[model samples]
Target: MTAPLSRYERVARKVQADGRVPALSVALHRADREPWAFTVGESGNAAHPLGPETRFRIGSVTKTFTAVLVMQARDEGLIDLDKPVSAYLDVPAHGDATLRRLLSHTAGYQREPYGDVWDTLITPDAAKLVAELDRAERVLPNARRFHYSNLGLAVLGQLVAKVRGGTWEQVLDEYVLTPLGLRATTVTTPRQAAIGYVVDAYSDAARPEPPIELAGVAPAAQLWSTASDMAKWAAFLASPERIDPDGRVLAAATLDEMRWPLTTTDETLWGAGFGLGLILVPEGRRVVHVGHDGAMPGFLAGVYGRRGGEGNPGALGCAVLGSSGGAGQINELVHELLRLAVELDPAEIRPWRIAPPAPTAYRSVLGRWWSEGSEFVFAWHDGRLEARLADAPADRPPAVFAPLPDRPDVLRTVSGRETGELLRLTRDDSGEVVRMHWATYRFRRFQDGFDGGPASAGPEPVPAG
Candidate 1:
């Protein structure tokens, strides 16, 4: 988006003032605009101001990275989403939890690894985690509901290590960090890391929080990164089709699968949902923000991305990291940045241009057809034969069809209405399409009753292209 930097800076400054955070770093990324980053608050050193490159622990946002790793394993045919994770790892408890459940927080695994790890700040290593698996309880039945569980993801990390024959950290570095050039995102503490703090409830005093090693459960929440790196990572999550065209990490189709909402995070409001590993938040019509939010003892982060709405918001990403923990401001700030970018200045609209005509076979079927008492408009758009109800919502996608190989008259609805159903075309002796059947329902150029009677004559079809 072409959103003004001053506008973002104003929001950043306001968020910093409202939270009284020690340090706040925000970054925005769009394909057509230069990356924009803003940092405000104390930098300790006057010579070096805190900036986007300064690392802050991202806590549960690391779950998103781990989720990608599991998807990669699936892409390589090493893991199956439907199979029980025990099919890969011989964990003592919750062996029946499927990989999909684990990824989507539907596994019913308890919130943690059977201990007060958060209170003690004493996370176990991989070995200890597996040995004590029996201690972890299944709080809910498998696939019961969306119960956020770090333990579930921790076990998945081990699953990746087991199937890949390496440590989770090592496998992650080799598979994701190194490949994505996310050198700043790592388990080890970086020299430029920002110290986290717990601001006093009554006073303005901020006490530094201790940094603990999440050795065993690190996959769920251990990595540290700057807003800049995380913004690009968020961009990849939302628009893998544009960012990772090579599919080195995961295919665009796999990313599509990941974005599909499976469980709602908020039961009452239904405002947000959980995808495979991503959190899906609907912003508005045809625009859903995909990413994750994280918080630890002293640090909080919000990293999210919104795909190009056919250029209205053109592949956008934002990351907001704060040094103070328990501050909802950090997460809200990131979302505000995204909203401002989309509303203030989306990508400039491209002038309409023309190319390539519809195929001869589809030309006859491309017009207006009536089916089930509804008028449908058909046309070849974006190289696909698509149809939609006359009164369909503007935001709803049309039913797009692809011809079956060697079956000239048959087409499959790959997406939109009646998906996976077939559209069969009937031809007359003159090679003109007479009528059609979609999803076993008859469609005709003229409105007709099912009882072999004319209902009413509608408008005539336009001449074929």
Candidate 2:
């Protein structure tokens, strides 16, 4: 047993003592380093020991992979995120539902396609699945709410098939699994797969449950993989350079966009918000790409990665799979492992540090400036000037400014790409700044003998194309 195992063993013993689960599997990886795998208890039958190679159903976690493929199609110009799903697939859209809305779970579709849960061991094919669309059309009225819908994801699968000119399973096999060298990963049934099991709520005992087959909603939850392969997938998400095998799976920019928050939901409390498919977590001082969690009839899993290239000194990632139905506990365990990984080696996952503030001698430039029809305040903080619009929205924060290069009369918006100039500070015999020129607009200090306040608020001058 390894020293880390001694620590992990204590955790496993505590889990067993709670009697919530009977088995667990975990895998950890860092850039340019081999992954660490651990298992406790019998995975399914109490006779077979779970190992790094053990496969498990990755429920909703499959959505992250599917989202990645959609991003790939978008990057290749084969599909547009803004386009309507009906544009690609012949699906009927009762309202103005677009692919972006569907991807972000804002389509307002019913939570589930069928009113009741279907047997996972027996699922319908794509064509048979589409026949149920009539019922799916009666989704909620307000499409902006974050309502997770399995039917909405099924529609996304249909779109992928239509755009890629193949079935969703075929697209996953050809574009994602094959390119990433995930030979053991697939949307279809495997020859040697781990049987799912659910813990008895009353007895606190475990029993094997039939595999939750998802032929119709495969895009939403049919993926299956071992901890080892999932480690590679997590590493790819954390360190983009390490696992983008042929550069065809997903572009770096598109991947970055996928990590960007499209919306925030109440289901998870982690970070800025949910992106295309992955969950964002505030780990320590920096945000990290925490993998999605999966829960099937008898299986549960979790995966996570760093936010940049593997070359980044401390990039780290991990994957965990188990043959238990209660995934919430396993998810918490993965987070604990992540915390330990960073704490054990701070240098490997250190938070980004901002550079120290520089000295600025222009302290007089900071003050409240008022013009007719407009009143704004400027203050200096951390060696930078900040501007606050008195009448702006409550959620919008103040804007920061930096000094213009080789120009004392100009200040640039710290968050903007362009610079603004403070041309001249007009003065009278009394030596008071009665008027000033900013950019091309003129501003009067609000004293009696000055021109009108600021110029008319028209569109800023734009360069000709």
Candidate 3:
């Protein structure tokens, strides 16, 4: 056998060839191993071979970075997501749109700023972008639907600058890029970058696209990132719990909040969704990709990391960047590579080993219990106490409980079905857990009926008989 990950290169090669792009660079990052990367085609420079470090404009993927910055600002009590921009900065119009609404693309703001800047190839500076806000249209009611607004994100970037007391680029560099060790992701195109091009449709020719500066809209669509840097970034977005356990760059819990779906991207198909500036594509019910697809005039990129699917949780990210073509091939390449890595070279399974059992006090809470006439099994697994319906599917997660800091008798359901609820354990004189109430419903050794007696204790023992 050739070995795991050997096939990944071949698949990427096929995509690059079929995509007919001038250059395509890709990277795969898993928690367990060193990052894997390669590039195919040319870097538009005869002297420089297109490689992993060759930067490509990531376009709207910049929004995800801005989103993370906004989240960090919120985390540090710099801003409230629910509050309107007017609460933070003075804007001519639409200052009432909330940060959360802007991030989720539900602020009902128009897609772009007031002018046909794209046609003119002229972009505004931060001040002009805001000052011209009066001309921008609020096409729908607040929070009406998913209407993407690059203008809204540009405004948010300005908000970040205003609150952080730095330019958006400077703030992003200090807060995110530097902290995450993303040296190659920058606001300006570097010398060692692939020239973005629009490939000819009917022939084997390509024309280089003119360099466009986003200026004020840079927060929405202005970033040049190498595949290696973006793959790690994508991984961070998907599994910050593993990539950033210490909460250095961004808290893992906050990332979780960002991934929570706000609205479906394709309403009829229910295929993809937008979440706090991230595009969430559910590959299946189990494996969801949390990242964003990016496109400028001549470049396309797809960067994503996996969550809730089979594979090494650590190695859950892939980035594909192309110098030409629509983003379809680049995006398809990432998904395909991710699948190959997981399928051909799945993570090694850890052997079960003997370890300390559940905490001593929770020992009595282990085993089977009946609640609301339904059979449930409570067990101590991996040092925590968990409860689940006896009939729950093998793959279904159980309700895991964490002990309340002040209340020794109470445990909160931290995750699984009855989340945010309490489990109150009742102990007898011996201090053994005799029964419990989960989410305020009683649990017993025997099935308990809603009326408060054992489900099996039939009708007062058939008094008539």
Candidate 4:
């Protein structure tokens, strides 16, 4: 191909040509390569082209930053996620609603604080917002369901500000943005930021959306960032160890805790769930992407990064920003970007090499075998006995088993199907591996009767008595 359109370029072109968004920019980051980015359409008007640095309101994605601060406070013993917000700040009812409940949107708090501010396009002062908390009715029992509470996150912002003895914005800069080198991300729209617009649903015309300043609710939906800056944030979410390295911002383990799903709204929707602060997404159990999405009056933004499992440990991420809201394309576009990246540019598989001499007991069973007419491979990889279906799809990784210390012929599945199940190897009279039992199912080697199939070229099966 002479000049193939890159994945980013193709997505950006599709986003722009859709004509729903006035401006769009997207970026993709993989651990092994530099980030790829593309932009199309105008930032403010028909002439100015949207670029990688063009900032857009990242609405509720601000909540993820706010949640990180809450988690940091928890790690420092400043706040307990299991304790009540009233234990930390001035709130009357819902004292039974724990910080964990609030963070995960299970606190049963009203979605918004008591106010006509949304209609007025104005947010109330902290004092007024707190004074109205008594009016926030609990629609559901505490920790019962996934009811998103903007007020709950605002209360968290207040907790951060109160604990740090600084404004929430200051604490955010000191604890997250500055530490992460997200220089362009800001609480207020920067001069280079694109102006938000709402495209008419019925016509091609669009109207400018008024700038809304979220005073007390800033933590819930008030931040502006570019795709470039957000790509860094996504990378950090995917693998904080590589990004932070020194734990200056947050530890890798703490980040992992954030990805653990706290609750889900429905049983049928396994793809969506709420974590401590991040989002837990299982893309058909093949891959799980963790991140957040944001939407304001006229802007939409999304940032998702792969939380790899099943032998896919590489870090990959995508960030999408659009100046037009209600188009619903940014979310889809960001997801496609991640899926394509994983499909086309997966991490290089570690080359297989001979392992050091295994213990005398393990040497006998570590090799190719057959189970249920399917070829299975058992080899020592990275110091563990890994078993894989030889004809397994490329996307599927092997089942890893850790040998039992007391018994050499026994192993336990640690990180795949039949996890925690014991694998007991059986030996013949001559001490050669005859077959293995896993989850009460027999697995025999190719030479071991082939599970009593047609006669093998190797040895004849000893008939059962």
Candidate 5:
């Protein structure tokens, strides 16, 4: 074990001692540095201890990699995210659901492949898998809610294969693993793979299970990888510059498009739905990718990479590979590891606070102004003026505004990151506080000749007290 392994080993031991998992491996990588790997516990038979080279079936973590390939294809104009999967595949799904919906789990397909195929070790091939799509049940409208569906990703994989003209496994190998130099990563079979084990719920015995062979749903959860390989994969996400692999996988702009939130799942959380095969978790100033991969009876794994920039200085990331079926536990361990790494190497602080705004000589600027094409009614909230989008659905929160430092006439969105200036109020010949200009839009108080007309074409001036 390397020096870095000491901290990770402590985490692995805690997991093993807690009896959550029998054997586990962890890897960590910093930008522009060699990856470190650590392992604990023995294989199913307890005959040998686990090592960095030991491969575990990474369940949903494969989705992140798959998402990348899809985004790469999109960058090359080989596939369109807005188009329906039926546009590429020979089979059709419930509605005109597009690939974007499928990536975000909004497609409403049944949680798993449409059947009892997973109960037995028998998995369907791409053709057989597509045939089952006809019977797939749509639970919710497209883009309704965050519903995780394995079938959705399986469909995405099929679409990638169709667009790229090869198997899902082949596409991943050629596009991602080969470029990243992941030697121990693949969709492996039992003959040349680590045997998975499950702790008998009723007993302390560890029962061996066959390797999960997911030819049809390979894009969903069929990836097999070691901690070392995953560490490199994590680094690529943390700091793209360190491992872009000839810039063929995904352009920075396209990757940013993937990271941008198409819709808000929660107040503080947003996701792109699907971009380059990864599930994005937005953490205020930064973003993180929580990848999933696993199967019953044998293995469960998770890989997460915190979004680089802003708060993440070195762009740190960690990978957890555990053979026991405790997927949730593995996820927790990785989170803890990341917390420690960030504390140890804190990112440079960027102060968002501005100097206090000066007291304004004019009080005319304070008044009700109607926002165009917005349901939000501008009013005061918690001692500060705000605009609550009235048309904003019950789930959508309102935007708040507060005075900026040294600029009393300008108000920015305090609740979210949106910044805008509050234009000074001007009175017409009638001596009424009529017009207020902001962000190129002129606002008239209430109904004072406010024709809802377009403002001047020239750039709007900055707010001055």
Candidate 6:
């Protein structure tokens, strides 16, 4: 018997009908709450009603899992993102394309192996795959643009296999899936799984798609998962630290690196971009989503979560699974649910609290100053010295500095436009700061009617107390 319809159930029904898919499932997750899931329509030729436990091939979403292993290898100092993959693997010469480029699909690798691998539903083994590397030519120069390449991820998988001394499947289970408690996500299709189909373009009829087993290229698109397990995965992606407090799976900062944009899919559409094995979807100026979409011969999947950049524990996610290929409605449905989640209840903003008092020496550096007639301010936050244009937006990051361990007065810009530059404080005979030089610009205390403008170079007067 069908269960009572929930809000999510209604949306899932609409999505299945609109996409003309044989079966569809959706899940929504939020922090500190149980996930809401719904499944509608039939599975395979049996007309069996689909349920939340029914697994479906997650396709290229597997790349994100492979990416996590690569990142873990990097954390262990076994791999370098800037170095060429050839330095670590025994693949054909790929010029100077780096590991970072491969993960971002900017390495310009051939989209697939030689011959009719896609049509034949056959992929080469490791030896056969490497032997054909010479035929895998670069379609464009490295970092030319956002190009999708399944071959690059397959190479990454091989690297993981080599470094861990285990199969890619085993390493993933040890490093990611097991740690996250995603029991239903497996490399092989489960017994209770949805049958993939290709819907006819001009009619309501559809044809079952023969399952293709990805041998060497399993890293590209070969994982099946249920909505119940995917909900847990989505929650982890939404906020890894909260979900994995022990950092057993991946470090919080490294996860942020994966979300950083490497390139844009379309130049005109700035809202859509690609990160390291992940997709970036901009909701507004403040909220950005980081996840991946997947599609194979007949299955489609999407997983997205809000990435709250600023100390905001932005925790919300949506996952969708469909049993039809080329439905072209998965992304739309996922986006709608994401928007709805945000609209219903926004992320909480923590209350402001006072930071520990600055050191006696650093206390003197706090307050407003003028640089080239432009107002600027230097203040202490969490024991660090940060400066920014006085008129800058409140939410924007500022140029932060750290005191040189050897020389307390000499500060180094750690982040922002002046990163890596030195800031030497100029003090008067009385040891009161008169002016300061950062890079090539000098800043002096702003005083009444001090229209001294910008001093290209000069010994500015110390502000009178």
Candidate 2 on 1-465: residue-level lDDT in tens? 656656755765555446466566677776645567776666554344566666678787788788887888888899888877666765444335777777777778786665465643565567766666665655665456677777777778867877899988898888888888888687766655667777887786677887556777888888888777787788777666656745667766566677766777764653435677677665533346556777778777878776532233434667777777764667777667666665544445456667554344444335656544566655566667665555755444466665568754455654421234333446567545555555555554332223553345445889999
Q: Residue by residue across 1-465, what tens digits does model 3's lDDT show?
A: 256656877787888778788899999898887888888899996666787778899988899999999999999999999999999888899899999999999998899888897788799999998888989999989988888788889999999999999999999999889988899999997888789898887888889988899899999999999999999998999888777888988998899899989998767998989999999888874778889888898899999988876655563889999998453688788888877777887787889999888788888888889876788999988878888899987767889999899897898998887899999999999999998988898888987678877666676555565
Q: Output the better candidate (3/5) by lDDT.
A: 3
Report the lDDT tens digits of candidate 4 across residue range 136-208.
7898998778998889888888888898888889999999999888998999867787879989989988899
lDDT of 1 by residue, 1-465 (tens): 234788999999999999988899999988788888989987443455687678888999999999999999999999999999779877787799999999999999899986899889898999899888889999999988899999999999988888999999999999988887888898998878888899998999988899898999998999999898898898889887667879888898888899989999878988999999899988767888899999988899999998535454455889999999967899998888988886777788877789699989888998899977789999998898999998888778899999899997999998889989999999999889988999999999877888645686545889999
Q: Could you tell me every candidate's TM-score relative to the true structure?
A: 0.94, 0.71, 0.95, 0.79, 0.71, 0.86
Where does candidate 4 have its weakest 10-residue lDDT segment?
1-10
Off by over 4 Å in 6: 1-9, 45-49, 309-313, 353-356, 381-386, 398-440, 447-465
Give the TM-score ranking, best first: 3, 1, 6, 4, 2, 5
lDDT of 6 by residue, 1-465 (tens): 123224456667788898898888888777745677878888884544577788899998899899989999999999999998778777766746788999999999889977688888899875567667788888989988878889889888877888889888889899898888888899887788789999998999899899888988998888999866765676666688777778899888788788878898888878788888888888764677778899988889988887654433355677899999988787678777777665544456668897788787776678998776788888898778999989987766799998899898899998765888998898878777778878857778853233455455556789999
Residue 438 CA displacement from its true place in model 2, Å: 14
Worst 10 residues of 1 by lDDT: 307-316
Error of 4 at 19 (Å): 4.9
Query: Model 6 lDDT vs. the true structure?
Result: 0.81
In model 5, the worst 10-residue window by lDDT is 356-365
| RMSD in Å for all candidates | 4.9, 9.9, 2.3, 6.1, 10.5, 5.2
Model 3, CA-based lDDT: 0.87
Residue pairs in clash, model 3? 30-314, 30-315, 31-314, 31-315
> Which regions of candidate 3 deviate over 4 angstroms?
1-3, 459-465
Model 6 deviation from native, Cα RMSD in Å: 5.2
